[model samples]
Target: MQIEPMATATEPTRKIVQRDPARTRARILKAAIAEFSAKGYSGARTVQIATRAKSNIRMLYHYFGGKDALYVRVLEEVLLRLRAAELQLDFESMEPTDGILKMFDFIDTHFGARPELRRLLAFENMNQARHLNRSAVIRDAASPVLGHIANLLRRGEQAGVFRPGIDALHLYTAMVSLAYYSRAHAPTLSRIFGTDLLCHQWQADHHAQSHQMLLGFLSRPTTA
Candidate 1:
């Protein structure tokens, strides 16, 4: 007689509990930033973002609508993060000159520390700010800092410390470019000069230099 195989007990399949929508959205955004920062907007994939987020593509769409929308949202979120840090500076509490100089120093720390934020900015710049241009929220987020810079300049002018008729936006743009230049061009600069701008000492020294240059420009007398 042939022996029959013994019957096996089948185990019940475990059901995945649905994560809260808010949590899932946050996770997707976090994962998308990593994905976008690593691959840039044009190269990022929704499926890979979902995989990195530990969710499904369906869920990613459910949270952010689509890839383009998600990419735009990623840019918004990164700018919002940077703006939030800037908003914490309390520029009004300090002396105008000190505040302006501190802002430059803060940029050194903020931009140097937040490499992903810088990468996103660089990527967005490469795209000619097309994605960044799509959001009104960015304007709102940026307005406060520009306003603070304007206020700082006005106060300096009133106190006869800063030069008269200085355009706040121009000065603000100059400060950013000066503060951002080293980190933005670090690889090329380091190769050329045989010095690493990424080093802490170099960053600190450059921060001082930026602070000095910006302060000097702001305080210099206007010649007709």
Candidate 2:
């Protein structure tokens, strides 16, 4: 599931007049995300990442230790972005269904905007998640969000708007799978179906279907 680099033409070389360590490091991390997403851990090159960042290989190593370290950072950053966004939603204060739908829409919009994340995840999974498993930061990122979802579900059940006995992890997994599977498999599915799954219309239709499916499932009443 490796993606072709979004841009392969190297930027024109420019002389360094001033240095901003924070900005420079951020630039390198951004470049690393693109490189790893495009080529995966094994295929990605340090030189390509350096060139994309307009920095040198030495700085990349300096900031991130090495290719493996940089790849781990990329994994952390992408997952952190999603988790942070989820945390920012005052879903606790909002009505249960509204909060859940808002969460769904956020995930949908985030994936649509950053297909690189889908690519990066696919790349890591292909690697047996050897790199991702090493990062404690990444491992612990989901707890709060899962707890938040559980609380949201509790509220919904109390209000009789959502079914009881839902597992937060299960719900979260369902939400992600519904949102992710289509985009991740778009190309292969497109070829099989003889249609452009990446097209705006196709994505929009799938989004609507996913939203309906999840909402309907959650809103169903629990049987006695």
Q: Best lDDT goes to which candidate?
A: 2
In candidate 1, what are the lDDT values of residues 46-110, reduced to their tens digit? Answer: 99999998999999988799998999999899778878888899888889999898777776677
Give lDDT per model, in order. Answer: 0.86, 0.90
Q: Which digits, one per residue and each the tens of the lDDT, describe model 2 over residues 1-224?
A: 99887987898999888989999999999998998999899999999999999999999988899988889899999999999988899986799888888888888888888989999999989989999998999778889998888888999999999987889889888888878888999989999999998899988998889888988889956579
Model 1 stretches astray by more than 4 angstroms: 1-18, 222-224
Residue 185 lDDT (model 2): 96
TM-score of 1: 0.89
Query: What TM-score would each prediction reach against the true structure?
Result: 0.89, 0.89
Indicate the worst ten consecutive residues by lDDT in candidate 1: 104-113
What value does the lDDT take at residue 182 in candidate 2? 87
